[model samples]
Target: MKALSTALTLAMLAGLAGCVGQSGSAASAWYDGRDAIPPRGDRIYICHAFGCALKTPVDFAGRDIAALRRILAEGRGSPAAERRAIAKAVQWQERRVGKIVGSDKDVGGLDMQNAGVPGQMDCIDEASNTTSLLLVAEARGLLRHHRVESPVARGFFLDGRYPHATAVVRETASGTAFAVDSWPEANGVEPHIKPLAAWFNDYPS
Candidate 1:
C-alpha cells in the first residue's frame, strides 16, 4: 500500500510538473542525498518553507547529507537510539511537509479534486504538495516506502488551493511533523523541510 501510494504521488507529481507525459522513464526516488540537503549536526533543526522562502530558527550550512545518513543509520542500530533517530527522522520529515498547507480550507471541494486527480492537464504546485506529504511520512518511518493519498482524502485542506492528507502510523515519542517538498528540478534533499508544531498538529493522537 505504501509503495503504491508513493508511486501514485510521484506520478501525480510528474503530471503536475509536465513530466508524466515525457518519454524517458527515469526512476527517481524522492531523496537521492544528492543536493539541497539540510545540516547534519548533533542537534538537528527542521525548518519550514513559506512564501518563496525557507523559514525557521535553524541554520542550514556546513551540513552534509552523508553525515546525516550515517547518523540515522547508526542511530537506528539500537533500541536506545530510537528516540534520537526518530527525532532526526521527524526533523527530516518536517523539512518537506511544512511547505504544504494542511488545513481544511487551503484545499476544499472542487479545487482539491481539480488539482489532485489526473486529467488532460494540471498544475505543478498541486502535485508537488501531494507528493511532499507522502515523502515525509516515508522518511519518518511511518511507511516502508513511498505512498500516495487515497482518491478520497478525508481530513484537512490547505488555505483553499490544495487538498492534503497524512500517512497514519503507530504512536511514537518522536511525535509527527509536517513535511514540505521542493521541486525535483531544484535537486537534492535541500528541497525538503518540516515544522515541529505543524508536523504533530497534522497527525493527531
Candidate 2:
C-alpha cells in the first residue's frame, strides 16, 4: 500500500509538471507577440503578469510628470536620496499598476504557482515593466541624476543560481550603475535599488 501511494504521488507530480509546461509555452507565445516599443508621450504601456496594455492606468502621463518630479525633488541634493526617491516613485507606480490590473494580492517573491496567469507577474514581467517605467521617467525629464540603461541579468543555470533580471541605470555624474528590481516585493512596496556589483551578488530574500 505504501508503494502504491508513492506511485500515485509521482503521477500527480508528473501531471502538475505537464500543466506548468503548457502554461509556460502559452506565455512564451504571448511574449513573442509583444511590440518592442518603449513607453513614450502621454500614454505608456503597462506590463503585468499576463501581458502588456497601452493604457494610462497610473498617472504617468502629461501633468503627472510634475508629481513624479515632486517625488524626485526630495532627493535632488544627493545621489543616494535620488535613488531612494526613484525607488519610491517606482513603488507608487507599481501600486497603481496593481490596482489597474486588479492584481494587488500577488505573492511577494518568485511566485511560480499558476505561472501564466493574468496579474501574477514573474521576473520577466517585473523587469520589463520596471524598464518601461524608467524610460518613461527619463523621457519626461523627471530623472535628473541618472539615466536609464538596458536591463541587466544574472544567475543563469551556469551561474549556479536561478535566472533573474532587473532594470539598470547609470548615474550621470559618477557613472555608477544601479539595479532597480521590483520582483521581490509585494504590491505597493518599494523595490530594491543597489549598486550593480552588490545586486549581482544578491539572492532572493
The C-alpha stretches of model 1 lying farther than 4 A from their native spots are: 1-63, 78-84, 92-164, 167-205
Candidate with best TM-score: 2
Candidate 2 per-residue C-alpha lDDT over 34-130 given as tens digits, one digit per residue, 9 for 90 to 100: 4324565645555665334332244455556776778888878888888999898888777766767655775667676746666776555666677
Q: What tens-digit string does per-residue lDDT give for candidate 1 at 1-205?
A: 9888667666544423422222111113211111112223322222223211221223323343443454456455443353344345434543433343221123221343433322211112322333433333344444422233211122222222232322222223333323332322121233323442353344321
Measured against the true structure, the TM-scores of the candidates, in listed sequence, are 0.24, 0.75
- Return the top candidate by lDDT: 2
Q: List the residue pairs that clash in candidate 2.
A: none
The CA lDDT of each predicted structure is: 0.31, 0.65
Instruction: Flag regions of model 2 displaced more than 4 Å.
Output: 1-37, 50-63
